[model samples]
Each structure stands twice: as structure tokens, then as C-alpha cells.
Target: MASFPKSPFPKPPFDRQKPQDPPGRDADMDPRPDYGEASYKGSGRLADRKAIITGGDSGIGKAVALAFAREGADVLVSYYDEHEDARETCRLVEEAGRQAIAMPGDIKDPTHCRALAERAAEAFGRIDILVNNAAHQKTFESLEEISDAEWEVTFATNIHAMFYLTKAALPHMRAGASIINTTSVNADTPSPQLLAYATTKGAIQNFTGGLAQILAERDIRVNCVAPGPIWTPLIPSTMPMEKVKNFGAQVPMKRPGQPCELAPVYVMLASPESSYVSGATVAVTGGKPFI
Candidate 1:
């Protein structure tokens, strides 16, 4: 194996800024997150594979798409109307000499989730990897502030969509296939402010564990990724300006992780290199232990 230089991580004391929506744009972020465009040397770990990645428009999802492309996998990026961000991700994947399909729709809808899988199969012949990474989060002072609608929407977008997409994609997945769900540090240490989001993450972790065992006989691997405070557009968009400025201070590293920082872990899970790895929650939390 060859050694590669590490990408630069942003220092503490970030400037306060916010995007207008729940899922923010990468272009709008002040200190743009590193998505391994100029780094992440690939050795064809996922050569000739086909993958579907929800929320592949930006942030952690985009980083994973780029890495998968570089490793020789064709990707289908599913996002929720982030046209520009989705296009940019596709462009990066294409630049890596792989196919990139950008499909814009709401993953919260079970119908749409199934359509995404069908489209991916139609475009790529087979689905080798399925990454349920799209998520929704909002901050509320207390439970009283969280409405029933808000709670339902959170579960619909986060956990339910994962179930829908996985069910749809399983038919296309054969032996040695991989399914990677995006859980969060909140699963182990829930954040009261993000009550709905945290709860869904907890469910996702359990879902991954159960699904892994259920599919073991089929030779399919299932796992999840739990990330801590990654410097993504989601921070400025959903969190308060004050919280955004000090987003990752609680971690021992005292800085939020960059999306690029988590790409390698995703690539490993998607590749044959992790054939023996399953039912595991790989945490990329910048020194924050998931346990």
C-alpha cells in the first residue's frame, strides 16, 4: 500500500452563517468542506460496482460519491431538489472516469424511494451498493416545541425511507452486495435539541444490525456509519447561528469533521475489501467515541 497525505481540517472559531433551508447548499457554506476532490487516491477498491447514494448532492454523501467513483464504481445520486449541488456531485464523479446519475426527488415518499431503485437498476444493470444517507434535522428548545408533524416528517425522511429503499434495492443486490446506512452519534448520545432526528438515528442503528443478520445467509453485508458534527451545509442551515459557530467544540478534537474525512470509511464498506465486515457501526467522529 502507498501512503497519501492528509487533507487539511478547519481550525476552531468558525464564523456564523446560515442557509435558508433544511439541507443547505455546498456553495453557500463559508468554509467549504473538503470532498476529496484534490485528494483521496484510489486503488480501484470498488471497480465495476454500481451504487445508489441518497443525499449524494452534497456534504458526506457527495464525498462518498466522489470516492466511490474514483474507486471505479458507477453511481446514482438521489437528492431532494438540490439541483446545483447534485449536478456538481455528478460532475465530480464523471471526472473520476465513472458514470454518475443525478435523480432529484423526495426520499421521504416510499413511492419515490422505490422509483430511485428501479431507475438505478435500469441505468446500471445491477445494484452492488446501497447507501441510505439522506436525512432531515431541526433544532427545538424542548419537546413541547417539537410538533407531531415535525416528528413524523423526521421519521419518514430518515428511517422509513431507508426501509423503503433497502426493500426495493434488495431484489437487485446479489451475493457480496453491501448496504450502508448513515446513523449518527446521536444514536449513542442523543441530543435533546434534535429529538426527532436523534430518535430516528437510534432506530437506524438497530435497523442496520437486524438487517445484517437477516441477510447474512444471502451473503449480503449490511452496516451503518455514525458521524459526529461534520462540517457540512446541514449545520448552517438547520442549527442556530450561535450553535453553528461552535458546532463541534464538544468533541475532543474541538473541531467539526470535514465530509472528505469520512469518505474512506464509506468506500471501504462499499468494497469487496470489507467482505468480512458487516453489522458494524463505523464511527467517524473526530475522536468522539460512539460507544
Candidate 2:
């Protein structure tokens, strides 16, 4: 008999964890998230490619960086101030016998977003894949709890930064280059508690659709991945203890996804194998359908 993917992941209710700020450290989590360190083996799918992955310090971004490296790509890991996490990501990439650079900065700032692109081009000579995977998310009960400043920051970090980074990377990206954005299941099924974050995710899907058409003549592919509940540092740090305990129970799989599980999809998107796939949002929703 074949085993299911969800059989390996831990299920809810998880250990009750206190909520901290966003971009939490994976080291602090009770059950450390997996980034395919033991399981994934690349087959030169992205050989000699040069790529940039934002939020590469932890979560999905880290997994993507590690996978890209194993697939023969040199990666520039762009991240926020998570120096420790960022260093670990670079180490993983280098351990795979690839060049890795950790560039820490605030992606919410347009200037930093531009600088990130410039740094990737400087280190790699050309940009073959651009993964806009860095994001900011906060949960709120109602509109009243969502402050004006918080709302603006969410949009700035989530959507605006993607625009800034993509625009900066365009010149360096040639005809076969790929651009992958990280959207969410919330883009279709808005989580009541994650109002602002969900709204921006919706915007990302629309942006990707329009931009894909705009860049089609250039032959640059643009797409996104909409992941459901995934066990990442951001979860324990952003959600309340009650919510954290029951984090991914709602999904049909009844468990939060491990970052490693989503890495293959990202790997495919960044590879030339996905040349015909653009303007599409691939949903990794743990059995929860999104259309």
C-alpha cells in the first residue's frame, strides 16, 4: 500500500505556543520545521542557474534556496534581520556545493528591494529566477483592530515590494527567466482573522495574472504558489496561542504542511521545464480546493 504525504507531518492540536512578532526563528519552535535536508536530492534541474529568493532566512524561502542549490543553482538569499536564520540558509546552500550570499535588509522598503536585485546581479552576473517569497502577515479579529499604519505596512511588505523587486530584476532577466510569487489559499478563501494579509494575497494573484501577459512578449514567465497552512516560523510567532494550538486542523489533511513538501513545486517553477507554465497559481492546499 502507498502512504500519503500527510502521514509524516504532525497534526493538531499542537503544543500551545505564545505568539511573538512576525518572522519568528525556526530554532525556537517546539517541533522544528523540515527543509528537505535529509530527503531532497536534485538532478541538475536548474544547473548553472542564478536565482534570488527573498525571505530566504526561514520557512518556504529557505527550503527553496536549499533546493535550488542542490539543483546546481547559485542563490542569493535576501532576507530581513534574521541573521541567524539567514546564515543557516546560506550554509545549507554552500553545503550543497553552490555559491550562496545572505543579503539582509527590509523588503518593505523600495530602496532595499532595488538593492536586493542589484546585489543578485552583481553576485551572479545574470538573474535566471526571481522568487518573491518574503512577506509580512498579521491576524486581526475585525477592521477596528486593524490599524491604519499596520494596513499600509502589510500592503507595502507583501505586494508593493514584489513590484519593486520584479521591476529591478527585469533588466537582468533574459528571455527564459522565471518569476515566482508566493500567494496564499487566503487569496481565495479569506481567513477572517487574517484580513489584511488575505487582501494583499488577492492582490498578488491579480498582479501575477496581469504581469504575465505584460511580460509574455519578453518571454519571461510569471506565476505564483498558493500554499495552505504550512508549518513555518511565522505561525507560532504571529498567531495567538489558541490559534497556534489548532493551527492546521481545518485543512482536510488535518496538519500544517512542511516546507520541504512545497519545495518540489517551487523547483519546477524555477526550472526551464516550466517554460510553458505562466500566469497560473499552483495551489498546495493540503486537500483544500481553491479555484
Candidate 3:
């Protein structure tokens, strides 16, 4: 278990909060996510590699996209609807001197997921990295309160889409390729209100483990990133305003992490620096304890 300080970040602005989607956004977030693009620079660690990232429009996905671009990876940014954020990410990718392709669609659809894989392959001539970062969550006070529809939607967007995308992309991925999934801290110590969402995350953990073993033969690594509370649009959109106000207070870091803090971990895992690392789950939870 990791340790976290029990303090909250200073509130940014309540009026600035808005719901963009299930995964939410940095644009309407109160304090807005820090992408750390200015500090990060590429040294050709992933030069010529092609990477596809879902939910790359905002939050952690956006941060990862920027870092990958900085590391010399041509990025394919996939998102649900947030065209504006997608555009911003694309601009940042170009600013980093890496190619970025914006693809907007619902990952919940198998066809869309397959098409995204095909598009990525077409864009870069090969698929080297796939980051399953898109997810959906809605609060429920009790397990009984979770509707079948909600559960289905959560699984469809979170786990099923990962399966679909991987199936499509794996055919094109050769040796040394990587697949990273974005799990959550809830998978270990779940929040009751996010039962459905947590369940899908747990499934993703197991999926990562199993797929790692299966792909080991081909030298294709599979892993997961489990994040704790960080200041992102998801908190304001899904939690009550009062809860949102105190978000990340339970963590050892006292304040929620900026997205920039999470970016380098992705870079490390995707780079040859961590060539021996795979079938692992790296936690960036502001010192939140996890089992």
C-alpha cells in the first residue's frame, strides 16, 4: 500500500466546472490539468514508433499523448466527442514536432474500435503501442441502485472496448509492441459509489495480466496504469459538488496530482528504459495506499 497525505488542494473555480463526457475534460475543470509539455522533451526514445491512445483529448490521456509525442512517437488521439480538446492535443503534438492524428468516435462500438486500429495502422504503417485509456463511470449510493443499463454501458466502454481494440490492433503489432490499459485505484480498494466502474477496472487488471502472459511469447508487452484521485473533470462531473471540493484530501500527497506528474510513467514504460518491465501495474495515486 502507498501512503497519501490527508489534505485537499485549493479549490480552483466552481463556476468553471462542466461535464464534457464520462471521462470529462481539462478545459472545464476547475484548476485545469497540468500537461507538463514545456518541461518534457523527446530524445528519440520512441523515434518512429506509432502510438494510439484513447481519450487522448483530455486529462491523463492528453498528458500521455504529449509525452509520447515528445519521445518521438507519432500519436493517434482517439476520443468520444471533445473535438476542441482533441484539436488542442493535436496542436501540442505538432508543437512537439511529432505527427498526431485525431480520431473521434465512441469506443464502445466494436466497429469503431476496429476502425481506429485500422486507421492507426494506415497512418503510421504499423501499430507499435496501444493505450486503452477511455472509461465511463457514474455514481451510485448502493449496489442495488446500479442499473443493468449502467453496468452494461460501463463494461462496454471500459473493458469490452479494450478487447475489441486489442483484437484489431494486435494483428498488426509485431514483436516489441506494447499495450497499456488505464485501470483505477478502485480496482484494489473500491469506492462503493463507483461499484460498476470499479468492477470493470478489476476486469482490466486481470485482462492485462492474462494478456501479458499470452503475448510474452511474441515479445509484445501488456500492462496497466492505476491512478488514484487526481484533479480531473471526472471528479466534478460525477461526484457531488461538496465531495468534489474535498477531492484527493485522503491521499498522502495532500493535494491531487497534476496530469503532468503521470505522463513520465507512461514514457518510461513505453521506452526501452523499461524494456524488461511488463505485466505490471504502475500506480500514480498521490500516495494513496493500495493493496
Compare the candidates by TM-score and give the number of the best one. 2
In candidate 3, position 109 carries an lDDT of 95
Sliding window of 10 residues with minimal summed lDDT for model 3: 7-16
User: lDDT tens digits, residues 1-291, model 1?
Assistant: 999875368766787675568798878777889999998888999999999999999999999999999999999999999999999999999999999999999888889989999999999999999999999999999899999999999999999999999999999999999999999999999999999999999999999999999999999999999999999888899998889888888898888999989999999898898999999999988898779
lDDT of 3 by residue, 79-180 (tens): 999889899999999998899999999999999999999999988999999999988888988888888899999999999999999999998899899899
Give lDDT tens digits, candidate 2, residues 17-60: 65557789998887889999999999999999999999999999
For model 2, state the Cα shift of residue 15 in Å: 1.1
Question: What are the per-model numbers of colliding residue pairs?
Answer: 0, 0, 6
State every prediction's TM-score relative to the real structure: 0.97, 0.97, 0.93
Q: What is the lDDT of residue 274 in candidate 2?
A: 90
Better of 1 and 2 by TM-score: 2
Per-residue error at 135 for model 3, in Å?
0.5
What is the alpha-carbon lDDT of model 3 when measured against the actual structure? 0.86
Scored by lDDT, model 2 comes in at: 0.93
Q: Give candidates' CA RMSD values in order.
A: 2.8, 1.4, 3.6
Clashing pairs in 3: 3-287, 4-251, 4-252, 5-251, 5-252, 5-253
